[model samples]
Target: MSGAYLEMRNITKTFYGVKALDDVNLSIKKNEIHALVGENGAGKSTLMNILSGVYPYGTYSGKIILDGQECIFKDIKDSERHGIAIIHQELALIPYLSIAENIFLGNEQASKGIIDWNKTILKADKILEKVGLREASDILVTNISVGKQQLVEIAKALAKEAKLIIFDEPTAALNEEESDNLLNLLLTLQESGVTSILISHKLNEVENVADSITILRDGKTIETLEKDVDDISEGRIIKGMVGRDIVDRYPKRDIDIGDIVFEVKDWTVCHPLQDDREIIKNVSFNLRRGEILGFAGLMGAGRTELAMSIFGKSYGSNISGHIYKAGKEIHLNNTTEAINNGIAYLTEDRKNYGLILINDIKDNITLTKLDKVAKKNIIDHNKEYVVAEEYRKKMNIKSSSVNQTVASLSGGNQQKVVLSKWIFAQPDILILDEPTRGIDVGAKYEIYTIMNKLVAEGKSIILISSELPELLGMCDRIYILNEGEIIEEVDRSRATQEYIMGCIMEHSKEGKK
Candidate 1:
């Protein structure tokens, strides 16, 4: 085998007595898709941070050798100067800025003490075409779809002439089509001799694309396997990462469905932006107490939009719906009214709509229900701490302290914080949208337990998920949504992958009919 293009040796990092990285080592080949697999807090990000200069040379005990020579990165700029670019999990792009401006924000094509707009646009356009993002350079970052934004990020890296691009959960939020496009793009980049280090929890994608895979567990390197290795299955990778064979990644749960507690009738919601379009066309469903009602749909099938519209018209321009909680009509025109009327929505995009990143866990937990921890507009710090502390333990949030910044926590913990905030509101009906989207298997099991516990307490849950297995595993009843309509509802006893897929096809046929 050829010598690694980049190698990290004896990487040891600590944070207040916690060994974040315990003598970890890694090697990556040139022009190869190298995958780094690990559970959350297993030092994947930390190791990447060290390499990308998020933790500068002096801060961590490690020797980074690139192209057979020692390298010392004092800052992100120093690393970027050496052609190392990192596309973070949460994308960093100016929403209001045009794609050209965002792509060439720092690396402008300026001349003679003046900003050259034409040259900048021209350079951005060239890089955009290189990344297969043609004709999108003039569109505002906000106007483009998320898939395109991701490509723009790649274009930005290409603009910097990035030799080594590190994607930290690049496809975590992307749908199947977008993710496929990105993987294909990565392959194209590889063929063009650009090395990539991908950190992801999606094992299927890793197994499909990665030339080699390295497993990290509890901040220590386990082992690295080549793509053609004899035992490079998903189970093998999971074992290496977790140090044990997980016979079943999706935990088993018994379904005990009961009486209907929530129902929506003729739920017609207009598109939030396009006034002429109707997102939910006369959708209707019933959710039982002590049962999980899964809303299954493909991307853009109006599942999320339906949940948002039902949860106090959070996203519809023109809405007409009738909701009954515990068999009684309720008025929930806004989020406040919805919360007061025993409804809570845990958004799929947690960072944007769910948690305040800069705020501590305590502050975030009390955000939804400040009155419970406040006396006449005065927040009781002790009470707030007590409440946050309780949920942190209850939800098994792995954080240094409740005082720790929410931004500093892992994706799983951030999701828990979001759940804690909503649970504190004590809603009778809870809507969970892709709760386990980017989390690891262990974290997902914890969330599933939490869901079971919620149902045990007699609260109704509406789970909106893209993963069919999750819906089949957790929900007592599943509703198949297709193109802004409820095509079919299958009970837990009768639901199958084939039936669900058929429902999707049935809806398509009806639309064509």
Candidate 2:
């Protein structure tokens, strides 16, 4: 244990009498990529926060030994000063500020109340090159792509002289290429003698890059497997995380797809800020009753743009589209009109656009369909509680009670609340955008089962996902989108990962020509 670079002994944290981490123990080797994995609410984040001083030393019961010395970190700065840095899933950078400024936000290059801009830029340039980011240090963070933003986060850590770096779900938002680049960067960092701890749900990436793996379940350490010694498989890791063997990743559904229930024809939308730039280009698609239709694409392929523009024009401008329900054309100029006309959209960004974090689950569940629990604009508290409780049980949302704030719930449970709200609205056509993002395998299966039930009840679904396997397993038919246009459509029997990717590549090459 003395030879280990970092060690946490008997780490325990609680929230409102609930134990988040119960006497957890972890050991990390020097200059190795260690992976921490678990289901939602499994204390992965809790442990990392304690290590990085987000929760502070006094708030948690633990002995953090760094480089053979017991360290007590009072704040994030304290940990940073000790060569510890953390990069969260959400990149923490000021959008309007230059990369150089963001890298040294608090620890700026200043002397006697005067900032040295040249020094900051030069230092940032050196770190950015280390992280393989080619963008100029003076470039604004807002203008860079998400992939570059990830690199910027790592560069910031390097600037802090971090010897031990932790990344929480770094690849969750990135596409395949971006994810590969980030994972490779972690390996590169490891080769350069920097120790890394990656917490992710993507088992494939973990297996690829992790030198050792630690599994947590229900706030307790289950097991730690060394990649070189143990038979580390995705199935083994999943069983340790969920406490059961999931025979099937997707639930079986009785396919009984009916006639077309919703159709969009020659739909086109221009960018909101750039008038002449098209975001969705003459896209045409249809959803049949009792079927899940999936849209597959790489990042920025306009799947979200098409869904949002159709749902009361929530995105883009200069929209031109023809939407039909049950063979009758409908006009929806706003979100209210779209909802009233039996259209519901579940946004990918559940925290920002989907849920009211500060509000209780009951309030959020019944927010979309207030009329159901109200009489003449007056809400009945008793009825609302009953409705919320019903959905809580139905969705299997793990919380203390329906009155629990949405912010306090896990990512999976929060997504369930969003689904409950939309289901209560009684929409005929539901657009689910990245419905299972950032959740565990078990949670993903639960969501897939919910989709099956919804379609079984004759409700059509428009699913948009970046995961090719998810689309393949869940959709009856898959549409490939590239550069804001639909390139090909394939039936479930014909859609393979290779076929879908091939379509995208073919179309991309044509677009370039």
Candidate 3:
């Protein structure tokens, strides 16, 4: 066997008296794309955190060897001194700063404490060219699309002269084409002798680019599979991560469709920052009882804008809409009003919008419906605990206890808490926006099962998703939106992924005119 460029042996970490990593081990070859896969809360991130020096050297009991030398890093910078760079999922770029400025924010081109603008721009432009980004380095980070911003992040890593780059859910926010581009870039980087450790829930992407796959489960190493030796498949990897075979990715719903329970008419919303720009244009839709109605569009297709505006005008300005519930027109002036009127919205940006990170699981679960656990405006602590515990068990949220902080939980468990919050509110119409964005396949199936359960109980659902396969699998009918307009409506029988993509493309072109 070839000597590994990086090796972590028998690593263990603890937080708040809980073992986050239990004698974990990892080995990566030089200039190879290595994938790390696991269920949420399976300790994938924790292991990576140790390697990145986020936890520092002494905090975790481990032996890290790079290039046959025993290494100890006290902090991130110490690791970076050895040419290690980690690009986070949420993106660390300052939005107001120029792309060049962001790329060299800390690692600046300077001589004797004096800034070198010419060198900075020249070096930044060269890095951009290397990454195949066509945008000028002077462009503000905010002015560029997310895909372009990702390239800037790569440029930032390149600036550090990194040999080993770690990418954590890098393509989670990107579109399909953008994801493909990023994967191709990773492959290209491999040819240039840049080693990578990819942490992602997207299994297909892992299969495509990874030369070796490492499966972690319950804070321990499960197995490592080499691409050329082991028969690597999504199913095989999933079975390793989950410890069982998943016969179905999407659960079957046997509920009967009922009469219209909620309806929207002539909904028009202007951008909050730019009043002249309409975010949602004359959008009309209805959800039937016991039905999963879908809204499909690419990024910035006004699907999220329409959902937010309809749910008590949470987004946009100058909104005009007629919302009806059970044949009676009702006005929802705010989020509370929307909830009281039998409507609930699950925000796509779960960390920023859907959750209060500092609070514990129990508190966050019952946060939306404190009234249900209260008597005479006084919260019943016992009742609140009971309710939270019930949802925790029901949602199968993997946590130490209900008292554990939501922030400390994994992304999948955190999402469950959010779902529990809204589900506790007991709204008739649930607008789920990207319900399974970055969760693992096991978690996705569980969520899909929950969706089925909700619809079977005669509830109405409006699913807004960027993934066409998800829309096709779970939705009864789909509405395709383009440039703030619903250009096409497809029934379940006719809603293939190809058909949906074609509709989106065709409508988007016409919208540009």
Candidate 4:
């Protein structure tokens, strides 16, 4: 391979006359961990798609050079033959298949129309060892955790003899320890002389591992910063990304604490399939008017179960809970009743539960409350259009028009549409579960601003997040849940990452006793 491993020169791509990438140039050296950062819709994914042959050679104007030779990639298979592999943000693994089968799904171990199962298992074992995964080769991919699935992806790439691997938001769903392990694996790959192009929204992780950083804004290349030569700090990177300095990530708000507005008592939920196994245990909490109460916990700790159970029992089976609004008991048997009772839940899995991807922004925005746009069972198209446009602008959704399909929009914009759908319902209490899971920092700041604005208008928010720093920054009070139970509650002024974790550990030890 040449000293400069790959280069894309003057790449320009357009979609339906819209310039998705305009005169973008990028170069990467061999064995370096290069990072790409930008706001949503800034052409990061578009550039990578072109490189990986998702967009074929003639579809876009660009010159791709690898190992000092110009190349034309016809499809993803062509790029793979040239030692290129991409692991997307959403993993592409079949759940029912075993680890060995998943690793060699297309390129199987076969000889003369006969498959060699033994060879496949043996080879998969070796590849998994290279990726530092110790799982059995025959274990089903569905049975493994997300972090292990990520390693399996890397192992698959290595099986293809990939010299250059691209990771697109690989740690978006992983917890802190899982993220650390994945980053360390990247370092190990670098030591083995593998080149990596990391596309991530987490600025801190980028700053931690990247040898060089490239910034993109609005389909154009901003600048590339070398770690040893440039500033390369998180703040410096943010300026290059958003084109301006953001003074604070979390918006400032005055505390106007009011009386208790919503409460749940003795809430318990059982697993949907395993009826006897309790997923949530007798949890009680209260939210005041204009308050942002946060639930912090590790993965599978039942934070989501608690939120869903309270939101009309959308998740669990055999649920038992007493919900009170202004100290009066109320019953919410279904989702419509929950909304009618002034409660809205923005689910964590937006693509699955929170949005109808085939629908347009206007349809999604008015989905929860179509009655507002109708008079005597007759729809008002003009009124709907105006309302959708107003929210499209208010949420700063980056789309060509409100008629654009939700699936065509970026992750952040899709999230904004979900928020708009619920906010239009005018709920007194909003439950947001991991509201900023896969979006960029600029978009995260915008969401935080919206949260501040909502609470300022006397709306209560129940935020369930795996991110401790976020809870500490934006919440008025924080509750730590461990093993399906609330272990401790801490005020925002007194909550720290160390302290919350300490409480969980203490509770775990006592439970063991």
Question: How high is each candidate's TM-score?
Answer: 0.94, 0.98, 0.98, 0.97
Model 1, span 348-415: residue lDDT tens: 99988999999999999999889999999999999999999999999989888899889877788899
The order of the candidates by TM-score, greatest first, is 2, 3, 4, 1
| Candidate 2 lDDT by residue in tens digits, 212-317 | 9999999999999988799779998999899999988989989999999899999999999997999899999888999999999999999998889999999998
How does candidate 3 fare on TM-score?
Answer: 0.98
Clash count, predicted structure 1? 0
How many clashes show up per model? 0, 0, 0, 0
Regions of candidate 4 where Cα sits further than 4 Å from its true position: 375-378
Question: Candidate 4 on 330-401: residue-level lDDT in tens?
Answer: 998889999999999999999989999999999999999999999998878898989999999999998889
Q: Where's the lowest-lDDT run of ten residues in candidate 3? A: 503-512
| Per-residue lDDT of 367 in model 3 | 84
Report lDDT (Cα) of residue 278, candidate 3. Answer: 86
Mark the 10 consecutive residues where model 1 has the least summed lDDT: 248-257
lDDT of 3 by residue, 27-77 (tens): 999989999999998888888777778879989898999989988989888
